[model samples]
Target chain A: MATAEERSRLRDVPIPAIGGVRWLLGLVVPALLVVVWHLLVTTGVFAAHQLPEPLRVVGTLYAMGVAGDLWGHVAITLQRVFFGVLLGVAVGTGLGTLTGLSGLASDLLDPLLQSLKNIPSLAWVPLFLLWFGIGEGAKVLLIAVGAFFPVYLNLSTGIGEVSEDLLEVAEVYDLGRVEALRTVVFPAALPSLLVGIRGGVGLAWMFVVAAELIAASQGIGFLLSDGRVLARPDVIVGSILLFAFLGNLSDLAVKGVQRRVVDW
Target chain B: MADAPSEPTLSVRGLTKRYGDTVALADVDLAVRGGEFVAVVGPSGCGKSTLLRVLSGLEDRFEGRAAVDGDDVREGGSDAVGMVFQEPRLLPWTDVRGNVAVGLPADVDAADPDARARIDELIRIVGLGGFAERRPAELSGGMKQRVSLARGLAYDPSVLLLDEPFSALDRLTKHEQQDHLSDACAERGTTVVLVTHDVEEAAYLADRVVVLGDQPGRVETVVDVDADRPRERTDEDLLAVRARIVEALGV
Candidate 1:
């Protein structure tokens, strides 16, 4: 207790030793994969038509950016995802909270949602195209439908799993229904809600790709389709890479929000 | 100090609770006057917690007449009672101040200067003045329980129900909490009903100790402590009362 060095160590918060090195370590695998890809292309392991060189894909990405096409497509796709996720979160959270809190609501709604969520997202594309006519509505609805189930399922499960002890505390405090929902139920279910949002965001990205594949004028999904028709592997590969990057970025954003909101 | 006679702050008569075929409590009666400190001590299965729950109006299915200051316990709202559970049961997401402030009425403005001052006072009373910004996860078990006690007192309840509030703590911390609770309640003149298994705790803190027996839990005996406050733990009279409680517990 009297040691100066030990006291200083205790007073100073120890920085994680691996923090800086871990970022470098993480790049190693991707770097190795890119190297292998370049080698395969240089050695002509696959035909040029089948697989474009990595440099060609980079050239295509640069050209798209110069033409302002990349930003336009990215913006449209992001808009669709944003609105779809917002709508899905609102509806799913509302319904999930209702069903979670009320036995009668659960009895009436759970079986239908359970059955509906099983249908693949692609299965709805035909109906959505027919209903909304390949417009913004069809694409947004598809993503929303894809995003709704996970948020609903996880939120309901999380709410149902709130500790009985805490619920008793709410009772003792005589918290009104809304007050309890805001203060007790919401915080208790936040971690699960964040998990649900993460799942929903992933599905939203996937659904956007599917939605664009069916019919779209401007989007990364349209790039994939246009590349297939024109036999340009570069565009296809570049679009796929952009999707991966954006998806990672969106998921990272969700994680950042989760860290800030659900500290416990 | 003559005043108009008033009803007991907490009263339960012929309280009976059953879960299907199992009776948790049967034909139990208890009364606690305003500012009185009563401790309920008994064996593990003696339904001490159930009684507290009934008195706190959390358990409504019990067949009994339980009231706080002439109002039916169930009808009296948050102002009637505050309860501290065995576990701290603080919202882990909230800091100490937020947790304690949750005990206040919803209509109260959290940002009001007076409200903030009262919250600070309660936190100081519980000896958590410096830790108001700490989350429950950041605190030790004893500290968390202190926050829980502060939250209970924040309501300024006429009757405070404690269900083994210090049972999870170590011996030293438990005694410390006991003293803190006694002082806090004495300062506020709030009636308290504490449920615990420790005979010594019951003897040291309670003005009256009610012993209960198991099987369909019922009151076994009630012992009154005539000793003064701040009495030493080793005081002969307190020890004798503790011994009688231990004997009543059939230990």
Candidate 2:
């Protein structure tokens, strides 16, 4: 049989730059909102008491920054988020990996975890305040509770989603159970674990705000709550902006870690 | 034919595999001497892959005796065997070098000078020297399979098993892999057992080609190529052998 010996390129055309354009389009709505907000406040369409001018909010932020209270609130909130996320991820990941590896273990704990997940983190505020007495423990525990489910569930799903062939690869290499868990399974589940961490980070922020509102503390949430009691709408608006800024910062941090660690 | 002498490198006797009521392979006996390259070709559902899976000890539910160098194939034990499946099956997270290096015994000095040296040499031998840091996602199908071959040969096994390793590639890439594999096997005198649906590939690569018939697979015929190493496709004798194997498939 006659055969052609030349190597063939099986139509691997490069993807178009259309995807980048679509990404740029994602910025439109947020930009429009900021523009409209500034226009409405500047035009006096909304009372200053109801909606502070953007410049006034910025000025308030500047004053807070000069007094160093902005930094303090941000630092304390971040500290709570950091420790809470760490503790939650550690326990959740361990439980999740165990559940994923054994059906019986998953069956045993999935229901309890699922039930706890259903109760919003706010529901635990009063109980947490009663137990830990509105201190750092209550706040941190509340954030930990919020972060736990996402990390646990995502880690479990990630471990469960691991390819059977990949497991076979480890087996063919004669990797022991522990070695396989560490090298093969852990790496395989990392993308989902990062997704889980992202979810957990977002939830931790939500709980931090709720905890600050219910108790005596210093944080961006505390700043927002203090604005309400003092009837200073400018501080409330400033604190909300601060929360948005820090939330975005935490998300960026998570993304950075994902890139550095997962390399995906 | 009085015992055709010398110890067999691999032997299968009264091997039987069944998937519930459907019998895959039954009462089969096969043998290969050291350094012999045997190719098995069969129809779609003829249990060709099952046989390789059995040999690799991936599927052990089958009733059979498969011995490699006089040792029964056992699960989770390091034997002198390696396998390349149809897919490259590279770990998406690991780079080319790490993927190939995983084949070496885990206890081997991964951080040592000797292991690193051997890994570099194998990468070069597979013509993938510059692509070591590339992830599997960044590689072509052909390059990925080359990494797969490098992974299989990294361990220096007594016998290498391939299950349609290049069947997924384009025709030209398939031919290149066949040529590369043939040369590598000849250079090392490695015992090879390959299973494929393509009769032409079997004829070109095997010292002995075994044809298997339809379901509940059994050997129909065994043809000895007896052609010189590095045989060209244009050679009349090689073409004749290829024709005979294709005709035996009754296609």
Top DockQ prediction, candidate number: 1
Docking class of 1: medium
For all the predictions, what are the DockQ values?
0.54, 0.34
What residue pairs clash in candidate 1, if any at all?
A: none
Whole-model Cα lDDT per candidate?
0.88, 0.83
Q: Which regions of candidate 2 deviate over 4 angstroms?
A: A1-32, A38-45, B1-7, B20-22, B75-78, B168-180, B186-189, B228-240
How well is each residue in B6-30 modelled by candidate 1, as lDDT tens digits?
5567778899998788898999998
lDDT by residue for model 2 over B8-81, one digit each (tens)? 88888888899899888877788988789999998998888888878877876878788887777764322677
Question: Model 2: what is its DockQ?
Answer: 0.34
Which run of 10 residues does model 2 chain B get worst, by summed lDDT?
B72-81
Over the stretch A132-201, how does candidate 2's per-residue lDDT look in tens digits?
9978887888898888889999999899989888787676666669878877889998888888999999
| Over 4 Å off, model 1 | A1-18, B1-7, B77-79, B168-176
lDDT of 1 by residue, A79-99 (tens): 999999998888889988888
- TM-score of the A chain in candidate 1: the value is 0.92
Best by lDDT: 1
Fraction of native contacts (fnat) of each candidate: 0.63, 0.37
Considering only chain B, what TM-score does candidate 1 achieve?
A: 0.92
